[model samples]
Target: MGPLNVSLCMIVRDEEAFLERCLASAAGIVSEIIIVDTGSVDGSREIAKRFGAEVLEFPWSGDFAAARNAGLQRASGQWILVMDADERLLAVNEAAWASLLRQDTAGYYVKLISYVGDRTGGDYVTDYACRLFRNDARIRFEGMIHEEVVTSIRRLPEPEGIIRPSPITIAHDGYLEPVLARKNKKRRNMDIIREALRRTPDDPVLHYALGSEFFQNGHYAAAAAAFQATLPHISPREGYASDLMLKTAYALRETGERAQARRLVEKAVAHYPDFTDLLELQAILLMDDEQYASSLLPLASALRIGADVQRQYLYNSASGSGTYQTRYLTGLAYERMYRWEDAHEQYEAAIADRADYMPVWHRWPVIALLLGRTADMQRLMYAQAARLPRSAWSLTANVWMNGQQTDALREMAERCEALRAEATVLRAVALAQDGADGQAIDLLLPAASRGNSGDALLYVWALYMKTGASREAAACLKREAGGNPALRAMAGLISGEGAEVREEAYRLCQQTLMQLAAWDCLDALHAQLPAQLPYPWLPLHAMYGYLHAPFASKRELLAQCTRRFAALGYAEQLAAGLLALECGGFAEAAAWFAAAGRQAPDRTAPRIGTVHAHAAMAQEAARGYGLPALSSDYRFLSICDR
Candidate 1:
């Protein structure tokens, strides 16, 4: 009946550049601003004070929840919108916020949109985060870095804390800054994660946090090892298993272990086949491994499950080398089989999803030309021309896209002549794509001569494939390795050159051991190393089989992987349920998931499969099937939107 008074609460440290922007985003909506400055020397307190934000000085207690709780205690508003200094509320969702606060909702969930790296929007848009809630007394916080409040919400009784959905997003741009700053931040997070790991050696979240923290710091191998450590601690039927499995697979893939990554991802899907993240990651990894055909399963799974509209756009853009990447891949698949219109529809659908994605615009013209749709080719070419950037690549695209009869070819040749060695290699590929193998060779040779060892190796390999010179390509790869440490390592791993392969493997093994030791787990380090010497590293499957097989071979290890994989799915559900329990005042749901691992043997090995509902049940079983309640007679019904 009355306007709801909302508080803006945040815990910040050294956030000067974007703190003002964050506060400004929510300025007009909040009744008060509570800022807890944890040892910020970066003008953060002064900036908050300028906006009439109540600045509370708190020494860094190495605990985020404590600072946040302190901020909450000082707030007077009836509802709280929690935001970090590096995060900003989107202007587009202002109306939704106003409506949400005015309603009788106990707490609201706000979506988080992250900008991966580039401001121009390429190669990113990774995840969403929940950032809104009621200023209810029941909600409390926990943990340090990546702290959450939902854990405390489970202690509430009755229907006073029901979760209401809020259609708003907070834009996170922390990753867009300089790489060094990002690295430094990750280093700090690593300390916190390591501490958490020490405190709870068997905690899956802590292991995952440590792994992810390592990955964020670009220590890919360390990340894989850390993620692997979490696998043994999971209670198979618990909900967080999927997330741990997915992240582990992601780390492996990023470390050039695509086969292992793909296999692990497949394992995740086997457990929860419809999990959108699993499906997407599987497709992405398959494409990177150049397994175009294998990529289709997860790609189609993603489509069949109907992902978010934004994600659907990304899935359709995946066609760099595979049909699973975009609809054009589907069309191209059909075209390969001479199913013309089917291919056309797939291409058309891909373009419709987002013409901005490179694959659709590039292929439509080429595909049209092949199908004798000259008119369609011309139309598509003009559309592409309008959208293409005014770069050297676009010039080629314009020529190729326009059903290039004569002038385009001449211009392309001239451009090829003008480009540098690296650019020339690219042009040669373009020329090859245009069916001018001889000219492509001409462009490729000179380019290869002037290129770096890496580029030269690629050129030689391409030439070998183009000219049917397998021996030459192999020899070139060997020669390139003599001059490049990175290449030498990659080549040894792939070619089975015993001495070099052993050397590289030893390094990886040593690094892995060091990571495990640093994180305080020696047995885990031993388990990761293969029993036999000179392990196969040709395809990723061999590598994955080596890392996971030893563990998967033992039933106890297998069960643990299953439980851990399941636990991740449970964690997400728990996050939502915890939020609901806090807002909805339903204590049972909280107690149901919070209690620890006593999952039943009959519950399918979590690695085999599970749905969200199944994951919830598995999590409950992991909690010993005795969900805590506010009162003896209270039976908490989980608020699930089926």
Candidate 2:
């Protein structure tokens, strides 16, 4: 029943905002508190003193270890627990702590969940650190930045000292965006890291640390270079090596070095075959290349590894390495292969595992519709409505899916009534989608009267265009354009008052047109356009309109669009080919499909389309009394189909 005699030590500078919360959380757990303030102008010192902490003022020597060691030296407890002023101890198992203290372990690894951004939905990155350790003279902190006491502990007589896992969880939010914007922490860390690297030029740990810092800052090229430099010195047995490899692969991918990234991931997977993160990355790379069938093996491997396995290093929560994520990725792979039944099963399993994962909810409906599973769709809608009862978006989507537009509009109005302008516009969009453009316009006009312009006015313009009220549509568009210069240029182009406006607003226009289902308006806009649209998909929208309004040179137009998209990439080419098939331009579709198949042989869409195209050609040839080259195409397609 005696005190465990745990001392909570912290080094802080201008951390008044978070210091009180941090100290209060550990007040009951820690027997003693040591606060080392390194030149804090704020009331951090007073805050620490208020908590009865032994406050020591240390000079700012740009060394985190020196400040940390000052606190450690003042601590009078049997055990030391190092914590930052911005971090709070969430939970601790006193029984486990007492048990661990009685053991011969030199240190304990505590779970540290650091919030990287807004923490509204538990958005955090988890890692384990040896923050709790025995209070021995040999166990002192090190490094100018990212200071650690592990190295000092490792130098003990038992170099491989037993480091046990303790039931302590710390939540840190200093890395979140709001905090980062207030304090230039990244730049400060970079400065210290550079200084340390300069002192110990060949330190692999410093290099890896620098690489991680750069990766977090979105400097992918610099991060990849630093990671590559560390690779030669990093030992495979070291815990940080796997993390280094994984981060390097991600950096390489971000830098557009996909081939190199794939090779590095594959190499890492070969060495650490059971690493679910590596396997998941491999599957993602394969999927990005459109090799859906090939991605299955890695996805299966990751799923088999499961979430129960203990991780040696830090892992991303968003990565598809966990049970729900692995199942979701497996579902995506199955869907790409056109195995709807298998895909549906995997998706259902994923939903069952983590019902609150919203991405699964969005994709599940599409799959259900594709498979014509109306009953399944209804079931999913009901389940989602139940799970996310407070989510207005989910409620709206559920009502819309159930074919209750009136109910959906009423729900939207009730749920979002506080934001009257936004709700009115949203309700109007729902009305427009339900073929009530006049009512949608009537709903939007009041907001327009109240001088609501930007998005609201744009919606009104679209409604007028949908109702064939050209004069009214133009007036609304011009009014909307008055504020957004980009819209002004686009409006001028559409109204034939100016030259073509090739800015990014074209995509927005295309999206708006698609939402309105204004196929004729899209065609009119496309005809007046001076050059090709920015995105390949934009043309497809206009082409879709031509599905009903067929033209003599439709195939030629489709072929031109397909060629343009083919030049962009395999994904775009596949999309273009599918659009062609949908528009009945079989020849153009066949050419693009063959091209895509050549680029990515494992893609099912291209292969299936090729089969359909070849079959159609063969039937036409037979009808014209001429033999077709069906055997070659059919054989290749059949192999891919299987």
Candidate 3:
């Protein structure tokens, strides 16, 4: 029935750019405004005054808590709402604030969304902070850098001290790239943190704060060290301990210490088995190692436990470890296992939960194609075209997939002509795919004329070769190759110049040759490649096997690639075994698959591969007795079609 009497408090310095916007956002709701200026050369003070704020001057003390406390002292309202000049309070109905004031709590945790790059959509981090609190002498801010009043609130009487979630939301853009670049905020914070640490050397909170700052600044090694140092001092009851462990593991992983990262995660999971964030991290680590089956249990645990544990005050576990994410990851694992039906089901569930998740949309068509669900694939393409109407790839794919002929494609291309090179390339590829080499060439000529012989130019050359225009193809290749030794060698070979292929050239040309389906050229390139392929070439070998092998010869080629990968210690044994089985190497494939199954019994790939291999061997043996065909063999054949 009456005003809530909220005081909006802020500490600012050179925040003229955002001060007015921040004040305007809260002007209607706040009863009084307290602005503690730490020294602003700009019009920040005038901006605050314009908003009828009670402006007080405070000398720069290099302590955020001290400045914040100064603002807190001047506040004269029943409720105090803390905010920065770079933050704006979201519009909430007055009834929500009235309801919040009715609660018997000392403080409330307001949701804070900090944008890093793009402000639109969900490209930001979610945090919860005690920004709303009773304006009492007992509650005051503390800490030098990452200051807080929550610790003081916790010292109040039990029932009166409860801090609960409020409807209040704040959007902070101080951490965005452009804003961060404008000021040396990290350096200033680091200085304050170091000074504070020097004063209180045993403070786990300072260590944690320092680690978080380092992580934000991309100092992974320093962040890892700081986070690791806090472990011994951190209490299990501390809400941030789980987050610290997660950050430390992530930092370690970034520094190429994945084993150490995994060990840390394992240790953390052992301690806090119910923490869904920890389980999700474990699942992700296992998935990264290609231990898909092993990943499923942790994923299942993560999903079963759900995101109930709010262990961290700053990080939102729901961003990546939510139900939709878990289902999506499970689907990916199923896909790797070649369990198309199971993968599709999980993917569909994920899409149902969050249709706007772009990765799910992208993978839907691929899964549909693999499962021979042409109608489903067409539906997905059309959906993508509608959702992303401006996307050239989506438009082209939709046109190509639907009953739209070259005329429709041309119309689409015309619509996208103003978009430049990317659109042109998409249209050309569509034309090329439709066997209109001349039309594709004509579409590519403008790009070629501008001396832009990138991938599109190479694609145009491939089209010329397809059309039997040898001289034109040679000329295009020569122009596009330029000074690049790899492309030059490729051009030389194509032009019948008898150029010797350099190892680098062969590596470079592999992609283009694959794209062109120039099997003979790939064969020549392969001969020039090193006998002992580097670790990075393992995927290239796999790609070569996929492109080169026909249905009848696929297993043998895949087995050869698998053996090479195995020799390099880079192949997932289950993947290799599947290839071996496809190639009819029953004994070796069966042995490897069994070993894999023994290692990860929960994994579906080895189990399915083993069943199909056994069935294939049985079917082969039964051929002598003229027995009926096996359904397992047919199922395996369907999987191998792609």
Top TM-score model: 2
Model 2, range 509-628, lDDT digits (tens) per residue?
755664555656765665666545444443432222233323433444454554455345555565556556656567877987888788888656687777877677677767857565
lDDT of 3 by residue, 1-642 (tens): 344699999998999999999998888888899999988999999999998999999998888899999999999999999999999989887788888987778988988888776453444667788999999999999888778988888888877778988778899888887788787787888898999999999899999999999999899999999998998888766767778888899899888888999999998888777766677778878877878799889888877765455444344554546567888888887766566678787777676555555566556544554455545644443455433333434533432323223344455556543334466765775575565667878888888788663467776776676666778878877877787777787677655565655556554455444444444444444444444644334223323223223444445444455545444331345555655665667666777667667777765556666776776688778875765544432233223212
- Candidate 1 lDDT, tens digit per residue, 422-504? 35444554454455656765655655566652254454544554455657756765665677675565444434453343545
TM-score of each: 0.55, 0.80, 0.76
| CA deviation > 4 Å runs, candidate 3 | 1-4, 117-122, 217-225, 248-275, 285-294, 304-318, 335-338, 348-366, 373-378, 384-424, 450-455, 482-621, 624-642
Worst 10 residues of 1 by lDDT: 633-642
Q: How much lDDT does each candidate structure score?
A: 0.54, 0.71, 0.69
Candidate order by decreasing TM-score: 2, 3, 1
Error of 2 at 473 (Å): 1.7
Model 2 root-mean-square deviation: 5.9
Better of 1 and 3 by lDDT: 3
